[model samples]
Target: MLLSVEKITKEFPIQKGLFGTPTAYLRAVAGVSFDIEAGEVVGLVGESGCGKSTVGRCVVGLHQATDGRVLWDGKDIAKLSPEERRTLRRRFQMVFQNPFSSLNPRQKIEDVLLEPIAVHGLFRPSERAAAVQELIEQVGLSSKDLQKYPHEFSGGQRQRIGIARALACQPDLMVLDEPVSSLDVSVQASILNLLTKLNRDRKIGYLFISHDLQVVGYISTRVLVMYLGVVVEEGRVDQVLKSPRHPYTQTLLKASLGASVAVKGEQLSPAQVVPGCAFYNRCPHAESRCSNEKQDFQEVDGVWRVACWKWHKIG
Candidate 1:
């Protein structure tokens, strides 16, 4: 496996009052597990604060997993020593959701791109300039933009720079957290195309996190639906998108199609921590079983898996 996440959980303690001790735990990612093969793109789809970004961070070693293991090439990343983890950093990289915030405003594009190479000692001082120039061209940025600071560029351009910097380490796996969500529709396509091209040419595996189902459907081979820090559904993109088995997945599709206009009650708050199924309260077809009993993932087909009790009944 290129990457394997086995029962990985991340919990954040909620502090109450001014001198509050931890009162409650917000389970961001609760026992999530999946695997990605080499050169494959796995899309992680969910509403905001569903812990998709947190899971991505855990996989890339940004946040140490609160439970279970994140095995990359048969090694648990959480167990790696500081030096070992630093060495393993070159094997995986991440592109953040916000391009503007990810880059330094004062640093020139070239410096930002070259910093990874310098830190990893990948290139000599004399060769670093040429390497930076090559990276700029690889990401479809012009060498002329090398001297420009991040604020001088448009949002799309800044994202392109982020992509270039992530690629500087020649990473085998990339966790892209809403890479195109911040750009214009027109620019989003261009960035997606660039990512697609990079995957094909470089054979880099991707864990793409996004709430935009349409974008995920366009690029991902497989889709994993997350809710309340748990994966409710996982399947091939077409299978899941066209015929979603979970009620939450169906609701998400409906929301994507702008069906929220017809819904009568108050919209479900995405941030609220749910008890059983994260989507149970919002699901139109939700039953008492949904609210009381936690669902477990079960295979319906060779390629599809869902965690809903009513999945068998739903076509």
Candidate 2:
């Protein structure tokens, strides 16, 4: 395995009063587990607040997980020393949802792309210029354009630059947090193409997080359906999306409109924890057990894993 996310969880304290000390907590990601093999794409899909982005952050070391393990190359990244984590940072990187905010407006593209290389000490100063040129060229930009600032490029071009900057470290795994969500449909196609080409050429693994089922279906080898920070279903993209077992998974596929579903359900609330199933209130096929006992995410007849008590009965 290239990366193993073992039951990761993250909690944030919520305040109540003006000088609130801490009234409640929000579990953004709750006990999620999965693995990404070398040169594979694993898609995480859910609604806007289903903790998809938080999982990506935990994988890339942006957020310290409140529980569980994030293992990279067989080492638990959370337990590593500061220096060790910094040194191993080059092994994985993240591409944010928006390039405009992620990239600096004051810095030129040359410096932006070169910063990672400089920090990692990947090359000698004398050999740096040619290396920068190669990276820019790989992302389909000319060296001449590197001298300009990020705001100088179009949305798609700026995204390409963002990708190039992530590639500057030559990562084995990338945490892509909705990398194409901000671009035009036509532009999204080109950026997706660039990512596909990079994966083919570099053999890099991707933890792709997106709300679009169609996008995930197109790019992912396996898919995980999340709701209220929990992975409710897991399977090959075709099996899970074509015939979702969990009610939440079924709802998400139906709402995407591109996927075929036999029953439709409503979007969920990302509120405080419920003792039972998170989808109890909105599940189209909910029963008494759904509101009383939280279902376990277990394998079903060696086909796939689901957290629904009625999974076997779902058609």
Q: Where is model 1 poorest over a 10-residue stretch in terms of lDDT?
A: 261-270
Total clashes in model 1, counting residue pairs 3 or more apart in sequence or in different chains: 0
lDDT of 2 by residue, 1-315 (tens): 789999999988876666877677788898999999999989999888889999999999899999999998889997899888888889889999997898899999999989999999999999988999999999999999989998898888988998999999989998899999999999999888988898888999999999998899888888988888998998888888888888777767776886665454554555576888888877778888888897797786454789987888875
Cα lDDT tens digits, model 1, 1-315, are: 889999998888765666777776777888999999999999999978788999999999889888999998888987778888788889799999899899988899989998899888898899989999999999888999999999899889899999999999989999999999999999999999999999999999999999998899888999999977889999999899999898778878888887763223443444455566666666667788788787888898877999987888874
Model 1: runs farther than 4 Å from truth?
16-21, 260-275
Q: 46, model 1: CA deviation in Å?
A: 0.6
All candidates: CA RMSD in angstroms? 2.1, 2.1
At residue 160, give the lDDT of candidate 2: 90
Candidate 2 TM-score, true structure as reference? 0.94
Error of model 2, residue 115, in angstroms: 0.3
